[model samples]
Target: MKNVVITGTSRGIGFELAKMFAKNDCRVLALSRNTKPLDDFNHKNITTISVDLSLAEDIKKAVSFVNSNWKKVDILVNNAGKLINKPFTELTSEDFLEVYKINVFAVAELTKNLIPFLQKESHVVTVSSMGGIQGSMKFPGLAAYSSAKGAVITLSELLAEEYKEQQIAFNVLALGAVQTEMLEEAFPGYKAPLSATEMADYIYNFALTGNKFYNGKVLQVSSSTP
Candidate 1:
């Protein structure tokens, strides 16, 4: 069975992604800050780990946990991220650094730490946002978050090119608003965001499709009219 490592598995898209992969008979290693109840689900193919990705030591522990046991990770989903919706001026320097630490630094470091263990033809999907692509007129009060995502996309592009010889795939899921707790907190009364499971389904398909034709690209998925 293919081995997949998914971060942010406590809830939202990450939770659903873990479930779907396990159901499809893949060996799933899920990481989150708090996964106390993960044992309750109790699937033999699933291993849930609780490690706060924002903390550098926690990130090291998580990567080492997977690397020691899983010989080759067939898929890696960098799904854990945070957003600070406060205005640019309102955000302290620490706030901006914390945001990047959780959203971008963690993802990049975790991937860097584990790339040696990734399979030759593996898929690496970084969950980003449309806010990462461009400035949003649909809303305001997220200058840092938007800019971080944009940086993530650029990183994905460079990694995609750098790893082309190995046939390893890298893709970014530029997500539109979704109905996660984060979204509810970021934009109250936001209309028509995709459900967590719906987004998970889209991501699951992309990861499982190892047809060699799909690699190093960004797939935009959403329920918005735009």
Candidate 2:
């Protein structure tokens, strides 16, 4: 069974993704700030960890878990993200930093620490947003959120190149609006075409096999104009 580590697993896509992988016989380490939801499910293949990705110590705890238990991670899904809906003029430096801490810096730090455990054919998938794509539709009040998402896409591309010789693959999925809590928070009452479970299903499959066909690439997983 492939060992998988998924972040933001308390709810939405991450929660569903965790169950999907576990049901498929993959060993999963599910991390989030709240572990209750996942812990209650208590699937034999799923292990829940309380992790606030913004903190270096929490990240270290995750790394230590992997080092002590799995030793190797077949898939690392950087699925955790933070979004702040504030107009540009109203946005603060701290706002930008808070978003980047979770969406960009945490991804870099976690992936960097996990590199040694990722061997040939290992895949690292970082979840991004359509708003992050340059020249794509830009939304107001998402300056920090969207920019941070874009930063992670570039970070993934660079890592894919740096690890090419090791046969490890890194890819980014720039997703459009999904009916997730995060989406609702950013755009209240804005109905999305896909559901969280639907998106998670797509991500689950892609994380498993997309590396064979592409690496250092960003796949825009959107069916809508937004």
Candidate 3:
């Protein structure tokens, strides 16, 4: 079975993705700030690690766990994210740093620590937002979140090129409005057209087959305009 390490598995897309991976017989190393919810899975293939991606120091435990338990990783999904819905004028510099800490820096740090453990044909997929992609529909009150996601997209492109010699693939999934708690928090009562389960299914398949044909590509996924 392929060994997979996924972050933000406590809920929403990350939770669904973990279940899908474990159901498919992949050994999953799930990391989250609060892992109590992960106990509901009770799947033998799933192992939960509690770590707050926003804190750089907390990421060490995740790296150590992976290093001690798994020699190689077939897939690494940087799916954990934090959203701060505040207008640019009201947003503080700390707001930007907090969002980037989770959405961008954590991904970079985790990937750096696990690069050696990535299998030769490993797939690395980072979740981003449509608002981050240039030319995509933009949303109000998402300055910090959008900018951090934009950074993630660019980081993936660079990593894909830098690690091409290792035959490792890196890609970003620029998702549209998915029906998750994060979306609801950002939009209040707005109902999104997509569901977390739906996105998880798409990501699972993409992690397995997408790298064969695409690298350093940002895929815009959504049914709506945004």
Candidate 4:
């Protein structure tokens, strides 16, 4: 079984992806901000690390530790994300930078650091948002989140071209409003607009089987939109 590393596994798609990989007998290395994620089943083949994505030193240490232990990672899933709802006029420079630091910079840096240790035929899946691709006009208070995710897609496109020679596939999953803890954390009292499990399963398959026809793709998914 191949080994996989998934980031942002404290919750949401990262958590589910880690479980899916372990279920298939893959050695799943999961890194999140939380040292012990609440949903962690503590499976034998799954290893969990807690490191802050926004800190370069912490990320370096985490990468060094994983490389030392696992040797080669067959899959890298960038799935940790958050949302902040503030009007543009109310947003600060620090706030904008913080969003990009977690959503784009950290993801790119981790992917770059793991490039040498990634297997020859390994693939990378970037979990982005439809807001990144088409923009989120319906949501007025999400400019920072939307802009950061947009940068993610652009970064993926460039990496897809650059890494194709090494047989490292880069693909983006653009999702529309999955029901995650962050959704509730940021929007309390709001009913979810969609299913998180369905989105997670869709992403699981996308990472496992999508490389066949997806040389470079911005794959989008929504319960309402095809």
TM-score against truth, every candidate: 0.93, 0.99, 0.97, 0.92
Writing each residue's lDDT as its tens digit, candidate 2 over 1-226 gives 9999999999999999999999999999999999999889989999888989999999999999999999999999999999999989999999999999999999999999999999999999999999999999998999999999999999999999999999999999999989999999999999999999999999999999999999999999999965
Pitting candidate 1 against candidate 2, the one with the higher TM-score is 2
lDDT of every model, 2 decimals: 0.82, 0.96, 0.91, 0.80
Best candidate, lDDT = 2
Residue 183's C-alpha lDDT in candidate 2? 92
**Can you give the lDDT of residue 194 in candidate 4?**
70
Q: Give per-residue lDDT, candidate 2, residue 38.
A: 88
Candidate 1 residue spans exceeding 4 A from truth: 135-138
Residue 81 CA displacement from its true place in model 3, Å: 0.6
Q: Ten-residue segment with the worst summed lDDT in candidate 3?
A: 54-63
Among these predicted structures, which one has the highest TM-score?
Answer: 2
Name the lDDT of candidate 1. 0.82
Q: How much is 171 displaced in model 2, in angstroms? A: 0.3
Error (Å) of candidate 2 at residue 55 is: 0.8
Which runs in model 3 stand beyond 4 Å of their true positions?
none
Screening candidate 2 with a backbone cut-off below 3 angstroms (N, C-alpha, C), the clashing residue pairs are none
- Model 4 misplaced regions, further than 4 Å: 38-40, 135-138, 185-190
Clashes of each: 0, 0, 0, 0
Cα error, candidate 3, residue 50 (Å): 0.6
